[model samples]
Target: MAVTPGEETLGSRYRSLRDLVLEELRDQIIERRLAPGERLVERDLAEVLDVSRIVVREAIQQLAAEGMVTVLPRRGAQVAALDPDSALHLFEVRIGLESMAATAAAERRTDVDLARLDRLIVEAQEATRAGDRKRATHLNMEFHEAVVDAAGNPLLGSIFRSLSGRALQLFRIGQDVDAHGLHHEHVELVAVLRAGDAERAGAMMAEHIAGSREGTIERVRQLVAEAEAREARG
Candidate 1:
């Protein structure tokens, strides 16, 4: 069945305008084009996307449910701000879920799954080498998501997807400073997964996520300090 541009088949009908809008907004958030605390005005978005206000509202609500935005009583929706505590909390939960998923994936991975992950990791490495931070970050996400899918656990996979959405915002911000280091971490993770050592793979996944969280916190703190210093000088 051929899928139309706006209309997918019955099996894929869920990929509607709302999903499209959500992805567009998500990309903005990930690239920091829509910075934290930026208000998402429904009328503005509708005009920007050439979609109806209903579509914009639904997309904003989905983002809000994913913790990427907050809908205030009268102030409307705005991008959620990241802080050290929230970053740490998200990583703590993600570490447990992702580590277990990687372990299970390693134990049950098929050749096809392994090949896909390898391709993703290689693409990420190439992107990093080319200084394509956005592409590198996206491929890095795809690699981990492929691992979760290989685990063959729907519930766990859903949780990982949700966490990844939130984490990607902070991850992108941190990538401005540590893109190369993050690329190295992806290389190490792929190596562990390919080795089929579930225990070691799981441990490596946990450590990688935790290290990212710590690095993000430190970077945010540094930013805060610099801003404060500038304020004091003024």
Candidate 2:
């Protein structure tokens, strides 16, 4: 049973043009087609995306609200700068939310949840083995979202959804991580989750997320400076 992710496109059956444009812009940023700190010129984007400037503006505003885009004093909109304070805050919320979600998932998860977790891990591990950190990272985030879904709380799911894009950006900044270690930890988490040990699941999730904190701020500082330098050279 193959899942068709469906034909999602600007010209396809999205609810609105804004929604399509928003996703297109987001994908570009995440894929580095739109680099960090790069200005998002509305007219250029509109022309490239073959949409109206108003649609691009609306999409940019939504991204601003999501913290994926920032409006500078002199600049209109750019991909959000890699700020250390914001990264730390993101981890704080992620650790707390994911810890709680894992705990609840351990207690409430259905067999379906277990199946989904297993599948995500398999795909993620395969991606890791293939040296496709980008795909692995995407799957890893999906793994977290699956845990939140298994938590059986709609509000938690929504909050996690809102934070995921920002989280993905940070993960991209740190994707040069130990792929094998990540796969091993994910394997362990699934085992604990399957065993329904709420306390263990919560602790493991916190520790796993916190693993990224060591030197991450410094790395982000280096990466941001490098990106700024690149922009300057252009």
Among the numbered candidates, top TM-score falls to 2
TM-score for each prediction?
A: 0.84, 0.87
Give me the overall lDDT of model 1: 0.78
Task: Report the lDDT of model 1 for residue 101.
Answer: 92
* Alpha-carbon deviation at 102 in model 1, angstroms: 1.2
Cα-lDDT of candidate 2: 0.85
**Which digits, one per residue and each the tens of the lDDT, describe model 2 over residues 1-234?**
111133443645546899888877877777777777788988877766667899999999989988899998887899887778888999999999999999999999999999999999999988888988888889988999999999999999999998988888777778877777887898999899999999999999999999987567677888778877887999
Candidate 1: which stretches are off by over 4 Å? 1-15, 176-184, 222-234
lDDT of 1 by residue, 1-234 (tens): 111223432223355878888887888877767866789988777766667899889988889888999988989999887667887788788889999998998788888888898788778888988988888778777887898998889999888887778877777767765666776777777777777899998998898888767678887677557656776999
lDDT of 2 at 209: 93
Q: How many backbone clashes does candidate 2 have?
A: 0
Best by lDDT: 2
